[model samples]
Structure formats: structure tokens, C-alpha cells
Target: MSSYSNDNTTMETTTTREDRLGYNNNTLKIVVGAFITSVAWICLLFTLIVFFAIFKSGQLKKDTINMLATLYCWTTAIYEDSYT
Candidate 1:
């Protein structure tokens, strides 16, 4: 009976260790995912701001290519924001 009790205790200890390791792995994944998402958002915002500056400068007001590029940038920003 004493041997059986010792075996049970050992099993419980092993299970606890496995659970703790799993929790740590999950936390690491969450942190990495958040970091990637933040970087993506920052890039998107930067692109939007750059294009906005160009659009507002009025130097390219009569340029068709500049207008198209500005429109594309705004559309992309709106589309990406919608998914979030």
C-alpha cells in the first residue's frame, strides 16, 4: 500500500510539470503573436500617413498617377482596418 501511494504521488508531480510547461509555451505564443500584429499595424499606419502627405501637398494635383496611388493607399488602409 505504501508503494502504491508513492507511485501515485510521482504521477501527480509529472502531470503538474507538464501542465506548467504547456502554460509557458502558450504564453510565449501569445506574446509573439501580439508583437507581430503591432508591427503590422504600425507599417500600415505609416504607409497611410505618407500617402496622405503626398495627397495634401497639392504638387501632384494634376498628376493622374499620383491620384491613383493616393486612392489605392486609402482603400488599402480602410480595408485592413475593417478586418481588425
Candidate 2:
């Protein structure tokens, strides 16, 4: 009984040591999952930034158009007075 118990202990210790020495399947899976999630988050952030940039560009165009119209109206009024 003592010898049998000793053999079991030795086998357990050896298996534990071997398994602890390197990356296991579970560890690899976790690492891959983390990397993929990080990439996805980065892509999401990039998409949000692009959306914000496009929105700001559109607002700037609208402001520019409004300014040009105002300038055109003032210039037309001035020319009309000068002609009269």
C-alpha cells in the first residue's frame, strides 16, 4: 500500500511539473481571445473618430456656405446703391 501511494505521488508530481513548464491549450486560447478583442476595440475607436471627423467637416462646409451667401447679399446691395 505504501509503495502504491508513493508511485501515485511521483506520477502526479511529474505530470504537474510537465504541464506547468509551458503554455497550455487554455492559456493559448485566452491569449488569442485577448488579442482579438483588443483589435476589435481599436477598430471601433477608429470608426468613431472617422464619424466625428466627417460630421465636423460637414458642419464647416455649411458655415462656409452661409458666410458666402451673406457676402454675396451685401455686395449686391452695395452695387445696387452705387448704380442708383
Candidate 3:
């Protein structure tokens, strides 16, 4: 047998435990997250619909296409500049 020395080893814990002094740890995060996400999406959709209603019939489509084109051009310019 060998000597039981405590000089070359640590004296720390080897297990993990959660502490709940006065709170609940079993929360419905998934359900709440899904609910918040769905609400955000619905709000965004309604905002888009209201925006379209405010503008002309096809104005929103035209504006979105124009913005997308501008974004594409900007990305391409940046990419070309990076290669130089």
C-alpha cells in the first residue's frame, strides 16, 4: 500500500446541487418563450398590415423591393472592397 497524503490533491466538492431558498426553479420557460415569440410575430404582422393600409395599395411592395435592392448593392460593394 501507499501513504495517504493530502498535499498533492484538492479538497473540493464532487457533486452539484441547486439551491432554492425562496423561489421556484421549475418555471415554464419554454411555454413562455413560445408565447412571447408568437406574440412578437403577430404584432409584427399586424404592423405590416397597418403600414400597407396607410400607404397606397402596392407602395409597400415597391418600397420593400427597393430596400432589398439597396441592401444587395451595399453588400456586394463591401465584399468587393474586402477582396481588394
Candidate 4:
């Protein structure tokens, strides 16, 4: 029989306290990356929706376009018009 000694315990880079909840450094990185990618996709979808909505409406006036642009910037996390 082989003898095991806990005194010589070597630390595992992966087996950490954070890994208990699957939120280690690597896990956090992956989650953040996925979130950023999803956000980008959502932003693209919103852009396409707004574009189609604005162009498809032949009755869109100057005021309507301005309103749409303002709303788009706001919803897209852009700064207020006063800051621009």
C-alpha cells in the first residue's frame, strides 16, 4: 500500500474556492465574454429594427426621425444630447 501525506499538499490552479460555484477566473472570463457578445448581438438587432421601422414608414417626418434617433441613442447607452 502507498502512503499519502496531506502535509505535502500541492495547490491546484483549478481547484480553488471560486471554482466551488463555477465562478473561477476562467469561468468569470468566459461569462463576461459571452455577455459582451450577447450584448453586441442585441445592439445589432435593435439597430436593424430601428432602421427598418424608420425606412419602412414612408410617412416619417423630420421630427419623427429626430425622435427615433434620440430614443435609439438613449437605449444604446449613449450619453445625453446635451453631452454631445
Candidate 5:
């Protein structure tokens, strides 16, 4: 809890000595992890869409495309393995 007091000269802010509830290190870590995961998923989806468009347009080199696909597979595999 907090309160603000004012006098003719200045204003003072005060809070309770008790600790705040419902938030801690684990909560912070979970929130950060969720945010990162969401951003990563969005980026991954965007990249895939762009890749598909480029593939269809036949502008990408076959070797580089294959390497990218392989890297994506490895990344997915690692993420799944780590999470599960």
C-alpha cells in the first residue's frame, strides 16, 4: 500500500513495509520466456512466408535454400528436444 501526503512546503510519498505479492523471480522468468517465445514464433512465421514466396518466385539459389531448410530443421529439433 502507498499514500501521498502534502503539506504547504512539499509532498511526501510513503508505502507499507510489507513485500509485494503475486510476483517473484519465477514469474519474471516465465513472463520473459513467454514474450521471447512469442516474438520468435512471429519471426519464424514471417521468415517462412518470405521463404515460400521467394521459392515460388525462383529467385533463391538451390544450395542456399537447402542449407536454410536444414538449419531450420536443426533449430526446430533442438527447440523440441529442449522443451520436451
Candidate 6:
């Protein structure tokens, strides 16, 4: 019985070490993927909100250069989103 208990303890310790070293775990990958996806979504939402706010303020219409720049930025943002 003592030998069995020792074997169980050793197995638990090895598993704990592997987990600490970030080996053999899909859980970490899933967590990192979730975090990155949430951040990307937040960035996309923020960009859209800012774009609408600028549009509503009439800044895009008043300045031709600014309008062009805004459009360029928005295009690049969309491109980046698709790329990611």
C-alpha cells in the first residue's frame, strides 16, 4: 500500500511539473486564442465607433483631405481585419 501511494504521488508531481512548464496542454492554446480574438474584436469595434463619431461630427465632409485619409484608414483597417 505504501509503494502504491508513493507511485501515485510521483505521478501527480510529474503532471504538475509538466503543467507548470506549459507542456502537453491544449488548454493554454485555447486560452491564448480566446484572449487574442477578444482583443481583436474590441479593436475592430473601437475603430468602427470612432469612424461613426467622426462621420456624425461632419469632419469627413468638411475636409476633402481628411475624408480621403479617413477612407484610407478605414480600408486598411478592414484589410487588417480580414488578414487576421
- For residue 20, model 3's alpha carbon misses the true position, in angstroms, by 22
lDDT of 3: 0.54
lDDT of each: 0.61, 0.56, 0.54, 0.62, 0.65, 0.62
Single out the weakest 10-residue window by summed lDDT for candidate 3. 14-23
Model 4 per-residue lDDT at 68:
67
Off by over 4 Å in 4: 1-23, 59-84
Q: In model 2, how large is the Cα lDDT of residue 28?
A: 69
lDDT of 2 at 21: 88
RMSD of 4: 7.6
lDDT of candidate 3 over 6-84, digit per residue (tens): 8797465433244334334444554565566565556556555666674656556777757645655654554444333
Worst 10 residues of 2 by lDDT: 1-10
| Candidate 3: residue 33 lDDT (0-100) | 55
Q: Which residue runs of candidate 3 sit more than 4 Å off their true CA positions?
A: 1-27, 57-84
Clashing pairs in 6: none
lDDT by residue (36-80, candidate 4, tens digit) is 656655765776687778789776788877876776665455322
lDDT string, candidate 2, 1-84, tens digits: 123356456422244554768756677667766666565556556555655675677754766556545655554554344323
Candidate 6 lDDT for residue 80: 56
Candidate closest to the true structure, highest TM-score:
5
lDDT tens string, model 6, 1-84? 123356456422234566668776777766776666666577667667776887788876657557546765765565455434
Q: Number of clashes in every candidate structure?
A: 0, 0, 0, 0, 0, 0
RMSD in Å for all candidates: 7.0, 22.6, 12.2, 7.6, 9.8, 7.3
Best of the candidates, lDDT: 5
Per-residue lDDT tens digits of candidate 1, residues 6-73? Answer: 64563222345657566756677677667666765666677677666876886556574566567667
Off by over 4 Å in 5: 1-20, 70-84
Q: Tell me the TM-score of each prediction against the true structure.
A: 0.48, 0.49, 0.36, 0.46, 0.52, 0.47
TM-score winner, 3 or 5: 5
